[model samples]
Target: MSDVAAYPVTLPAFVPEHAPPFPGQPPAIARAPRSDTLRCSTCSMRAICMPQGLTPDELKRMEALICPSRTIRQGETIYRANDSFQSIYAVRVGSFKTVVMHRDGREQVTGFHLTGDSLGLDGVSSGHHSCDAVALEDSKVCIIPFHLLETMCREVKVVQQHLHRMMGSEIVRESSQMMLLGTMSAEQRVATFLLNLSDRLRLRGYSPAEFHLRMTREEIGSYLGIKLETVSRMLSKFQRDGLVDTHGKDIRILDHESLVRV
Candidate 1:
């Protein structure tokens, strides 16, 4: 652990935002829409996930480029490292965890994607995915074929800028993770993780104070660059101090400001 004290870190809550499940309720299963009826213009998540200020004609063209939603079963990978990158997916119905395998065969959890978030951008650089995107539950994703998307970008300035912004968000996310691992203590890392998750859920229109964590403690530890025991200890300490309430996988933030100060 670093000797550096915990500081307030503002993390990026990136990408096509999902309409959250009802506050304090479990996420609902997302069903795949029929190909003919699928349109980005009609999606509930378009306001947050799509570009702002596009003309009607451009919107129609953009809608034409998106394929019908595809369902990814729980624990199944949507894509894996070295897989040919043909399209990027926007999470529409469920959550996912992206991971990368180390040379030693240990898998490191990298990012957790909720509904309305984008995936598969990792493949844009080399034309192959660099990690595995596995669904945390039965999930649905809107497939945007990248080559067609490139063509759309050439035709639509807003779409091109939006793509650039999405790529930039990925860069910022990676930089934030590096900062977390390099500068924070184990306790701080855990606290920051909870705070960040809370913010993201709130943005998605879910309950900011309480929600069910989809990832296991080990997976959370992997993402935070801490041991499982340390992560457990910190959560327990938070509960004891009335900073949070926990029941198995459920977490309620009781003291948001204190967590930020942690």
Candidate 2:
């Protein structure tokens, strides 16, 4: 499953037709070596990335599986729905949002990926990807070939356990999103969204009470199953009620408990 863009937790993302695949074989991200070394240790988010605790030798083997990190411009599609799945990517910088296009042409957002998270779980069960990964900002990702990861996991018990846990987390997150969309009111939706983002940021050692929303209001609305206008109104309401303060994308939660109550 995807993180933000990791599949529904890997495809466990909520599927609503506010929307819009095909058949394909499995695919590698192998490429020529780059002039500059892109060591996991030297990476910006190394302390929090998946390979953080690996031994030097284990890290070396993991490095062999990564292609040089490259920038993905905002709006670029990292992988389209049904494309051949060769690897799952670790976000190194910026963020991403995944969407699945329905048969009826509607697109349902599944998840959002931030730095240190992985994407591309949709390819695990099938040879092809099950959704689309789009950059929400100028971003970069560490592409890990799935087979290489599996091979490493055979020797590194920790990696395997972590992978399992990460995938399971995605499943639970997506299920919760479904319930939120189906049962929550507009205010509740917005409140839940704030808390979720806050928690993820806190996990990354950033402040949970304050952060910038990389996602737009419209995107938030789509994920929360409300209109963009409603998302805006809810924010205004939150601000007026002193539960939060918003200045464009930068938001500060003034009353986390009140939001939890919502």
Candidate 3:
């Protein structure tokens, strides 16, 4: 496991801004909605997954093969490096970071998984996780047992295509990260990270330009390959330029385009 200091990170408790009153209402329902049902019916992420092309029977079969898990609190470790990889985890809500420690004990964040994202796919062959996955906020995941999923994929053409697309996306993200690390300035890095987070939140049906940050500035710096002070300074500069509004831990993007152009 990485020797990265475990710091407390909290997700803003998600309170639906437009939740309607009464059970079985038009807007927000009383019981938390099932992610699988949502994914099957309403998720914009279907384009990247094979679920969209599956028949009703196939969808039902797939849904039955997976089990939705509870929310993992911020700062909690979902899985540690070298642990047995029993199931593939899909982020139904919230975000998670995967990290690996170098020989000298320095930590490198491998990637951040957002809603509709999956982790532990890389460990399929090895049966042991390669990195540590930590929740960045109160998050929920659907655990799909590898054996069941694999069997279904073999039987369903759409499932195979979906898995292939997901892997391709992961590769592209890694490549983008490498390029960003190699070419971007500290200011650019910070701006890019914020923009990415904003975009991700928007995809999850939240306010894109205005939302609370889940990770601390230090963690943001670590992920972006910069110092904590640099992250603070850049954010302050953005605030001064009217690119964003920051009140303690809360950040609201006043001018998203300006921040992106930085």
Candidate 4:
């Protein structure tokens, strides 16, 4: 592994006045939401995940179907490929990357999941998970029992509709990634990836313009369908062109609009 400390990152302080507050935005603190409850009833991410718009009574009922959040250390597998799928997980802290291995032993990264993201939805169609959910850092996840969730969905229209929407959103995201891989140039792909990550960080109450990248350049290349050297070259070009500042895992986006145009 490369020694990340060898690179020093320059990140600017977040200036909130530059943009109007987004509706339903959480606090501006750059950390994962506080986990004060074992269930969705009191979660800080309730506005983003399943509990959004749910009634107090409904949240209480949801507690029954959820197991106490479980912690997964870095490099730990939340669920291995082909494991029987029982529950979908809601990321409560930290991030994770999902990967799939083929018969010949080659592995491809599927997705990077952050707080409020759902994992294991792919297993709903089949009985087993197709990808491995591995923690990118020390993480905690709320295990939502699928069987009980299904029962609730039948009784609650919101539950059923929300679950369908979540699944549909995942499908749409995958389709967008397919487009990114098959169509965009390496520089454009990197730009799009940065924009997407920035947007996600913004929603999670982190600084959109400055943040640490948890994934390595090789991992980013694998996910973006580019070579590692190409990724490195484009990043250097971006820095030289005044688009971003990078140091090891840390990045500071200098021109969001210029990147969008690339």
Overall local distance difference test of candidate 3: 0.68
Q: Give the Cα lDDT of each candidate.
A: 0.76, 0.74, 0.68, 0.74
Task: Give the runs in model 1 whose Cα sits over 4 Å from its true position.
Answer: 1-38
| Residues 173-196, model 3: lDDT tens digits | 777787778999988988888888
List TM-scores for all candidates, in order: 0.85, 0.84, 0.78, 0.84
- Order the candidates by lDDT, highest first: 1, 4, 2, 3
* Per-residue accuracy of model 2 over 26-100 as CA lDDT, tens digit each: 111222222435577676566555544688877767667665665566877667777777777888788989888
Q: How many backbone clashes does candidate 2 have?
A: 26
Q: Pick the candidate with the highest lDDT.
A: 1
Tell me how many residue pairs clash in candidate 4. 0
Candidates ranked by TM-score, best first? 1, 4, 2, 3
Question: What tens-digit string does per-residue lDDT give for candidate 4 at 60-79?
Answer: 77776676666667777777
When superposed on Cα atoms, how far off is each prediction in RMSD?
9.8, 7.1, 10.8, 13.1
Best by TM-score: 1
* Candidate 3 TM-score to native: 0.78
What's model 1's lDDT at 16? Answer: 27
lDDT score, candidate 3, position 18: 26
Q: Model 3, which residues run further than 4 Å from truth?
A: 1-50
TM-score of candidate 1 versus the correct structure, residues matched by position:
0.85
Which 10-residue window of candidate 4 scores lowest in summed lDDT?
Answer: 1-10
